[model samples]
Target: MKQFLIFVKKECLHIWRDRRTLVILIGMPIVQIILYGFALTNEVKNSRIAVFDQSKDDATRLITDRIAASRYFNLEKNLNSYKQIGESFREGIVRMVVVFPINFQDDLLHTNHAQIQLIADASDPNTANTLANYASAIVNDYQNALNNDQKLPYNIDVQLRMLYNPELKGAYNFVPGVMALVLMLICAMMTSISIVKEKEMGTMEVILVSPLKPFRIVLAKTVPYLLVSLLNIISILLLSVYALDVPIKGSIFLLMAESTLFTITSLSLGILISNFSRTQQSAMFTSMMSLFLPTLLFSGFLFPIENMPKALQIISNIVPAKWYYIIVKAVMIKGLGITAIWKETLILMGMTLLLLGISIRNFKIRLA
Candidate 1:
């Protein structure tokens, strides 16, 4: 019995000595809980919306004030014309727009009926639907308050206009998100594991003695995976269009170019991971923990980023997948041109260069 107890103590000491194992056991759970607790919410709050109050009467003022006062919405802009609404959506300035028609209160008072137009950016159908519903409920509440148990009920019709995706197809949102998630995971995981496998098999030292520089070695190792990732990009685009019925509304060439850029960025990250990881298992585990969860959470694929806490939103800006996801959505779903997504494209390019530089530097140190 004493011998068995001593063996158990030795095993415990072994586990305690391995910092990576300790982190996976204790630190991962804490991080996962925090991310899930804050980011896994379905309730959309503080959604930015615009108002086009043409009526400018007492009733219109009251209803607009109520909407602006609600916890769910933050009135961001007061649009001047109908043209500004589309510009706001394309620029990502607002999610939903409330337009009170001309003589709105006059119609309500004289005919006991009025209409309020709700125009929403429906590239994300779920958020669009939720915002429209919330606005409609608020309008109904105003109607009831105005009626105040009168024999005749006042009616306010909420005319919902879903731009970009009139049918509210789920594929519009799902395809872009899946594109970002797949490319990020596949490129990062495969490249990391492939490079780490060489180190584990003791072949990397042999290769290091050859004439190729560290940068060339890193480039040669990653090129094949880059090609494989491009093939994946093509397959995903075909499937999204044919099977899922999601159209590539923008320039296919631009989309492919952007995808290639993001793939390179992900590969750079994988090479950096390989520098720190000694085995294929460690490479893979690090890829999943670092790439998978961040792609899902910070990429705005699963949840609305605008609804997250200020701290999480700031953290999300550092995630490369977040910008890629936004680019895909803008180009694929909304059919916006390069002009609309230039900032995001620049950001991805900067990340790729930065990560590639660091990974190559690490490779040189390892080779030495």
Candidate 2:
């Protein structure tokens, strides 16, 4: 017990003493959370749009005024001709253009129907869709106001209720993802580098010849990192909840438990990497290349897996972070119980066991 405590203390000191490791462990999560929460967002605000109104009537002007007053759009140009619409889009000066035909008011007043053309730049499909929805909503509001005193033969109204994320804040999606990413980076990358650093410095030889068993040595090396990872989890949760207003609708205990499971899985992978890498540089490179990119891209963090190509979807299934991401969204956003995410949880558990078994075998062989 005394030797184990001493070993753990020694490992903690080593971590605390390294400036680069300390910054990455403590600073990286905070920076990533703030950047992703504030900077990267799907919500559109003050998008530039052009208007082409051939009618020059009250109805067209009223609709244009409503669109310009709304926070989602800014009427930057009033194009005179239809040809100017394409020019505005080609110049990249406008995201959308609203065109009202010459008989817009006459058609609306006499025939009770009119056409309003909305042309959006589909270069960024998500932004284009959002712009179209906003414009359609404005037009619908205008139509409802015009017919408030008259009754139509048939009317259909659709009520939209956004669940969990009512405001559609991107932080709600990114917080849990950042948690998964940070935990994996700290546990897998840092641990592998630490072990490889020991081997490079000849400390592994000294530790191997000591009274401690090999597994005990590995445990001591990992215990400090486990505690550090737990601290990071707490920090990320506090920042996400208090700073970003991201809610934890489900069991906090379950969230922490799953996070710990993923941490252990990442640590096992780190152990496996350390067994193969003799230098810290090689270990760090391997962890970054193998863990970081997959967690960012294939885990449905930045893009939805359902929208990805079939081959990439198949490739993403093998990523551990992909399963962890699903578990987190279920627990944190959907407020689901274990039954809802049992499949993902089981997959992570299986991966952890497989990685741990392989790492143990490799470490034993290295000792032999």
Candidate 3:
């Protein structure tokens, strides 16, 4: 136990002495979070929607049924009052709301015109735009049906109102993706390269000669990075909430706990990379190719995974960051609790254990 602690201390001291690396580890997440949060914008779909139907008339019911049946929207709530619209958006319950004013059918039948309002949480403008278009198309189809049956033309005007982020800032969408990307790259890339550095320096052989087992040595090497990653997580969250003006609607404790779990998962992946890599260059390239690209492509942030080909969508299930991104969005943006995210949490846990077990088994084999 003492020897293990000593190994851990030595690794910590070594990292402390490397000022540039320390700065990069601590500083890069902060920079990336701010940069990506402000600069990027993209589209998303398959969003939850709510309906505020003031008219229980047949026309309103038909319109609500059409919107709910569409693949692009899920009818999650039927709000009783106007006040629930803000509550739903703030709680992340629904992305878009469909409202039918009172006397909707009467207005359409007698006056030949009625209004339907589409209110969306425009924190992600592209999503809002797409949803509005999709919903409008559905309503338009209903109008077309009415036109075919009756002599007087029927018109249903779709009015749009954007809530939460009226300006449609990109930060609301990008911050969570940036968090997933930054942590996955920094923790995994740094860890793999650091372990490979020790191997290249021939210090690993000296450590193997110590009384500490090979697994302990590997754990010692990763401890500093795990600690650094926790710090990175804190910095990212602070910047996200303060600098980016993104709120953590869920429990902060749940977010940190999940972040820590993901950090361990990333560290385990790094350790696995170190096992195969003969040099720091190869380790870095491997981490970038394997961890970086997968996180970007499969994480469902920059691109919608549901939009991908069936095979690619299946492939995305294996990426840790994909799950982590979902978890962060649910916890940080949606203000959801563990009950909403337990499946993802369990998947991450299963992944961490599987990766750690493989890494340890390989580390033991290599040392022997």
Candidate 4:
């Protein structure tokens, strides 16, 4: 036990002595969390919209005023001709164009209905959809106010209540994603590189010749990173909760447990990578190619996995980040307990065991 403690202390000193590793371990997560929380977002705000009001009447003016009053849009320009609408979009001055026909007010007053055309730049589908929805909602609110206390022939109203995120804050979507990505990168990349660095420096042979067994040496090396990974988890949780106002709707203990499991899974994969790599450069390249891109692409971090092709979805199932992401979203967003995410939890556990087994086998073979 004393020897193991000495090994752990030595490994921790080695890690802390390296300024670059310390910065990447601590500083990187902080910067990434802040960047993702504030800058990268899906929610639409202050989108510039152009209006081509051919009606030029009180009703058209009133509707346009309502749109401008809404927080989602800014009335950047009023178009004189329909031709200017295309030019506005072409010049990237506006994302949406609202056109009220010549008889908009008259048709609504006499004919009980009117037509308002909404044209949006579909180049960015999500933004365009949001913009269109905002414009349509404003128009519908105006129309409802106009028809107040009057019964329509068939009124089938649908009330939409956003379940998890009522305010539709984009940070809520990305905080967990950033957590998964940061933890995975740190645990996998750092561990793999650290082990490979020892091998490259020929210190691995010295460590092997010592009384310490290979398993003990690997454990000593991993213990420091495991502690660092836990600290990273705490840092991210604090930032997400206080700095970003993202709520931990479920058990914090459950979240931490799941995070620890994922960290172990990543570390095991890293150890496996280190076994295959002969140098730090190769380990780094392998970690980036294997862990980073897969986490970013297949884990539903930046894109929806359900939207992916069938084969890609199948491939995503093998990604540890994918399961961890599901577990996080279930706990943090939906406030679901272990019962809700047990399948994903089990999957991550299975992956960890598999990776650990393979890494141990490879490590023993190398020693032999």
The candidate that achieves the highest lDDT relative to the unseen native structure: 4
What does candidate 1's lDDT look like per residue over 1-368, in tens digits? 45334433543454458667445434433343333334544567799999998889999889989999998899998988999999999999999999999999889999978899999999999889999999999998887778783544464555789988786655667667777877787678877886787777777787677666677667777765566567667766776677657788999999999999999999999999998988899999999999999988989888889999999999999899999999999998889999999999999999999999999887743543
Candidate order (lDDT): 4, 2, 3, 1
Screening candidate 1 with a backbone cut-off below 3 angstroms (N, C-alpha, C), the clashing residue pairs are none
TM-score-better candidate, 1 vs 2? 2
lDDT of each: 0.81, 0.89, 0.87, 0.90
Which regions in candidate 3 have their CA more than 4 angstroms from the true location?
A: 42-167, 364-368
Q: Which one wins by lDDT: 3 or 4?
A: 4
Q: Candidate 2 on 1-368: residue-level lDDT in tens?
A: 89888899999999889878788788888898898888887679899999999998999999999999999999899999988988999999999999999989999999988999999999999899999999999998888788784646695656899999998889988987898898888888888988888877777888887788776787788888898888888888898889989888999999999999999998988998999888888998999999999999999998999999999999998899999899989999889999999999999999999998888777742443
- The 10 consecutive residues of candidate 2 with the worst lDDT sum are 359-368
Model 3 reaches what TM-score against the true structure?
A: 0.69
**Weakest lDDT window of 10 consecutive positions for candidate 3:** 37-46
What's the CA RMSD of model 3 in angstroms?
13.0
lDDT for position 206 in model 1: 71
Candidate number with the higher lDDT (1 or 4): 4
lDDT of 2 at 141: 86
* The 10-residue segment with the lowest total lDDT in model 1: 28-37
RMSD of candidates 1 onward, in order: 15.6, 2.4, 13.0, 1.8
lDDT by residue (1-368, candidate 4, tens digit) is: 78888989999999889988899899999999999998888879989998999989999999999999888989998999978988998999999999999988999999988999999999999889888888888888887888784657797788899989999998888988998899888998999998888887877877888787777888888999999999999999999999999999999999999999999999999899999898788999999999999999999989999999999999999999989999998999899999999999999999999999888878943433
TM-score-sorted candidate list, best first = 4, 2, 3, 1
Compared with the true structure, the alpha-carbon lDDT of candidate 4 equals 0.90
